[model samples]
Target chain A: MTALLEVSGIEKSFGGIRALNGCSLTVERGMIHGLIGPNGSGKTTLFNVLTGYENPDAGEVRLDGVVITGIGPGKVFRLGIGRTFQLTRVFIRLSVLDNMLIAAQHQHKWLRSALRSPGQGGERAKAMELLDFVGIARLAELEAGALSYGQRKLLELAYLLMADPDVLLLDEPAGGVNPTLINQLADKIKELNSAGKTILVVEHNMEFVMGICGRITVMHQGRALLTDVPAAVRSDPRVLDAYLGGAEDEGLEAEAVRTEGGSK
Target chain B: MAILSAKAKPISKGKAAVVVAAIAVIAVFPLVFTNPAVTEIAIFALMFMATSEAWNGFAGWSGYFSLGHAVFFGVGAYTFAIIANDYKLPAGSGLFLLMPVAGVVAMVAAVLVGAVALRTKRHTFVVITIGVFFIFQLLGYNLSITAGASGLQVPTPYNWNAATFNNPFYYAAAILLGFTVGLYWIIRRSAFGLQLLAIRDDEERAKGLGVPVWRVKLSAFVISSFPVGMAGALFAFLIGQIYPNTVFNPLFDLSWALMTLVGGIGTIAGPLLGGVVLESVQQYLNLYLSNADIYLIVYGVVFLAVMFWMPRGVVPTVGDALRRRRGAGEATIAATNNGGTDSSSEGKATGSLAGVVQEGGK
Candidate 1:
């Protein structure tokens, strides 16, 4: 059978530097997949390409053997691949629950979908259930902008779940989060994985990535270095080199600049 | 689950009472004050309110910030005139009956025009709209079907010289205004409306969250164009004549945008309140002043004052002040959310998408 998601030879460039080059991976059904890399190593870029936020220069991405390349974010999302950003994006002006409502209606025919209230009965229950799943159910009534940083991440995850995407792409879910929240997030990921969802997470935090993901993919300089079980990935010398040997990778500032230029 | 969705903001009992009373006062306005001159101001007020509200629906909520909505207004007016001439419709209600056709024609034009214009990014989008506006304006001057600069004189209705001359126009404008406001109110509460508000906040994020951004923006633009086109038709009938300059005036676009901005864009009452007050002051200024240029200066001042003093617009500012007076917490959801929305939306008035970064993939 075809893998749940398959990517082969994806390439993307910005100005002079390659952000993603010949990136390839396969995510089996229901696997908690980890994508970890050093700074400027194409983890976010890969996610962006996979989700159609960035159209790859040369590549094929198939979901269940159906080629889904450069379909655009809206179509990609409607096709059941949900993604969350690193910095925790949510509609600050909208109430938290309405955030979920927006998610469920994105693919609906605008004429009919817009006129009918998506806030009624089943959808609202599902929204609350997702919010509860992410532990932000209590904050549903408040505006998303009013959420604390950690709470906003939870809300972001909650809204993504509102769409019930088959594959979840979470970028740095543990970044800037406190330890308590990190543990909570990891638990949620495991619970979600066991309940029949496939997840691909890009994280800087090794413990967070290793603790939950069933398999891990290590990327270096815009290419996947290896994909192995966490124990095998943990002891890989190349993974250590990708993290440490590159002097520029040590500073957060250079990674940030590359991220803004490459990811967007 | 019942978290305050946009649909959740019910009109309070007191607010509802005030709304009913206001509508009552307006319903009898032409009768209570029979003078055509007074009724004329109310008529123009209604027309502007309707137009500004139309502008607000797409430009205000979707963050598209079109400066060329006058294209729809003019298209509607010209559609009415062209259809009337083709069908040889008479001067009375027969001519008036064609207004909805005018609206449909404008809606079609908006779909075509907005489809092309909406493809560009925010700043480029503004420029394209302005460019289209000029093209239509030039077409008004050159097109033979439009009778060139000679202008088309509409047939005068039976009530042209009667005491009730402005009454039909007045009531029609009022109905148009009411219809526009009600439609927006429904739209603002609908799921579509929520998506629009999301687009306005951060378009990239909204798209990332799965919103079909371009389709939503285009839908709103077309929807907004219908009322604006109808309003133009009504205005065309009221004038009993049509010219490219008269129907497609840049000032109409400018004034409507200003009215919506000063009234508090993105809120239903804001456009209505701003449209009526600003248009009344404008008409009143025109009545007393010998020159029209002076009122333009007044508009300039009002624009600056609105920018500096009540940048968030009258309704929002007043609402906040009231909430503060009621001893609401400093960090209440409204205040916290508005703080982010206030800045982005104000920039949106000039068609800046400073907050949107995620759309390069296309």
Candidate 2:
């Protein structure tokens, strides 16, 4: 199998502190990959670098052996990498369907987008179908802000799928989701992987990540600690040491804020 | 017969009648109120309506509040004046003819302005817009083509009847307002509009979704310039002269934003209605009080009162209450932002959504 997404020696620093120091990762075609690290370990920053939200201070990211760095998030998305934020950044004031339509905005030429409703005839049905797949079809008419946090995560997943991306970078898919919904999300990820879409998911929910991902990469202090099957990674002493008393919500938010501040 | 049809989303009969009636009233206003003072007030209101609607079409929807849109207005006025001066048109022969050139020139100005200003967002974008506006204002003052602060005089229609002189200007303003309103309505429902809505709500998410936020924003800013520049040209024609200070006035910027904010910031009808009512109120207070200080103070007080009561602006605040009254329970940020688009239609969507849920249970 070939590596669909490969990053080598990515170096990023926010001020004096290094966020990504020579981080390297590779996801083979059609693989379900898990990226896990403790708070401030640079998992999210690496995601940012990979998705073109931040330019790496050094190193390379390649999709199908083509270098993609410093291209910006919009170009990154068009290059077939769709991502969901850790904080679930759906358009709060748009209707649920409208949010999905914004993702399905593939016919992105100026005049076409202006003349047709964002729900271009085919897109409406497709958006509704994806919403149904995500189990939020019933709430599709409501504003996305009115949705519960877990529902918004599901909506984020559903909408990103509208682009039919070759790769998806989900930042903590099971973070605050209820158990039943977590199972549903897990099943959906597996289904997506089975359907030929490669995925790299970041999660603090160890069981969900270990159960779904075929290969797991552990990060520590802006560097890759190790990469192996979930069982071997879980049993590794180095991996356990890197985790640093488990990933907590406050730490995640603090990292989110720090990286956000750094980006600005 | 209607119950059997599949149409559940279009505007209702009552709304249609109300819209038709409003249009009829607007169409007849100048004819019925031939008095110059009343028509003058109407003409100014229509100008504000046009400019505010165009402003809202960009800033209100995209969440980039530009306090320097008067640059486009000034550019349009100057374009019209310059063309008229060089082309040597007879007095009143083709005054409105130059207005389209004004619009095109304004659009070109928007392209240059938006290319730079749209790169930033939030407070920085606002500041950049102000900076761009001042640059244009300074040009209006210093440039030889603009004739400095002395300004340029353009001729009004020579044969306008004394009793009905304001009528022609009034119609010009009204037609421009109509055109702007139509564009706003179409854009509000377009996919491009939704993308703007997304950008306003979350720029990062919009980008991640491949919405082309930068280009979309620039386009909206340019589209907004056409009507605004035309309104500027019309204002120049009405006054029969244009000055740098008057055409590039920051007051124009403040008023367009204030009217949109007071009417309903992001909704289609917000700026249109807000401009008319707010201008009328300002005009009424000035007419009665006749003192600049007192009337200006009174206008401020009235504006504060409007905000205090309708915090989200007239259309959204009222639309939210009406939706709640009808049991849609759509009392969210969107109740104020999306205007009244998704209210009743949601019921029908919910009905079908429920059926799908039941089917899923199987």
Candidate 3:
């Protein structure tokens, strides 16, 4: 399949440290692509670059054959890219329904939307639907801040989904969610992908990543070490060394069992 | 057609009673005090209400504390004075005409300042606005049409008889108050108001949700300028004179800001309540403390007290108290409804956490 997103020779640096150095990756349409790396391996930096929160020193980011580099987050959103933050950057004071409506509001013209009430146009109904999709429909009327850590994660996911973006960037959906909710989130991602949506997830949860991701791209020190099917990538010597520091089959078997259980 | 027809949902009895009581008290105010001086005080109180509401539209709702709002007020006063005195327009008509003209001027001023000042952080923005006001004040004093420092006298409208102009000031004040209140109601009910609240609580997050921060702030700034300009024109007409010193007085600005802040920063009723109370206290203090300088000191103390005691403003604090009482009452009702067992625990658990997270994020 043609690459839905293409990054060519992307390079970004903060002062003396290289965050992303000559990093390039292709994300195909209708797939849950995973980007996994250790802390400070430039996973979040790459996400920021893709979402236009940060500009690469040198690179081209093409979304479906259209170059979209150095654009602001709002413009990136307008161009069919939606993102959720790792820290759950939600509008806290607003009601759960209002949060979703605000995200969905991107579809309207700026001036008109500002002047007119967003509650109209079936936005409330749609927000409730998204809440239901994320299994947090009952909390729609409550303040978003009142939700638990796991629920907030789900709300963040539902909020991004309201935008109906072609490409969804989930920084770490399963990071703070409980085990039960992790499985539910994985299922939601699968459902989203099966419905022709493109997803690029950056996650540290190996089980969650290996289970749902159609393809996994492992990174180290800001460069993509390997991109392939999860099974092959798991056995690769370099991938093992980079991830597990040359651990034997025991570590690999444990990870495989966890992935299977997480998928279930 | 259905016979029920929604049953008109009898206006919440509690709210209705309060509204009725307030109206009765307001209607009897003039009767209780026939002294023209007290009546003038009442009129001034109403005018302050309008000004406070205007300020609240931008500062309170949108979280843009514009210290230079006095510019719009001064512009309105000067615009009316110039139109009525210099241009030789009819007095009452001139004042009304100047309202829109001053509104436009203020809107333009807000846009220009907002373009540059909005780019800065909150405190810097406030200082920039104050700087803009100082510049306007200097220009007002130097400009010939503004009567320089001497002040211009506004001739009463030719069409009105003695009684019309005599009590007409009170009527004008009432109309202005109504207009201000109505405008606030529209804004608060509209999507723009919600967006403003969202922006005030958190700008970046609002922007991330595609709020068009600049546009929302600009629109509010423009709307806020209209009333302020109108208030200035009315002040000029009521006093029948305008001077740079009188029109662009820092005392008025300080009073308006302090009153609005003490009344409640973000609530709709805050400015109105704050303005009335603060202006009344000022009038009373003037009766005893004849020194204007002493009044300023007293005003400073009042502002300090309000800041320390009620940081969120009077209205929102009252609202929180009322909400807490209602929540307690509801809890009892829920306990009774569920046979002393709270099924609402699940709902409360989820709802409470959501509130905390939202507050923490804010």
Q: Taking the tens digit of each residue's C-alpha lDDT, what string does model 2 give over A1-264?
A: 899999999999999999888999899999999998877889999999999999998999999898989998877888889998888787767778778888878656767777886665567778778988988887777767667778888999998888888999999888767778889999999999999999999987777888999999988889988989998997888776665445433443454444434321
Name every residue pair that clashes in candidate 2: A118-B191
Per-candidate TM equals: 0.90, 0.90, 0.85
What 10-residue stretch in candidate 1 chain A is worst by lDDT?
Answer: A255-264
Task: Output the better candidate (1/3) by TM-score.
Answer: 1
Q: Assess each model's interface with DockQ, reporting 2 decimals per model.
A: 0.40, 0.39, 0.36
Against the reference, the lDDT scores of all candidates come to 0.80, 0.80, 0.74
Q: Could you give the C-alpha RMSD of every candidate to the true structure, in order shown?
A: 4.8, 6.5, 6.1
Q: What residue pairs clash in candidate 1, if any at all?
A: none
Candidate 3 DockQ vs. native: 0.36
Model 1: CA > 4 A from native: A246-264, B1-9, B158-161, B326-362
Candidate 2 chain B lowest-lDDT run of ten: B344-353
Task: Give per-residue CA lDDT, model 3, range A1-264, as digits (tens).
Answer: 879999888899999989999999999988899997656678899988888889999998999999989977777887888888887776665667667777776688866776676567666677777888989887765656667767877888888778788999999888766788889989999999998899999977787889999899988778898899988876788876765663223344454455445432
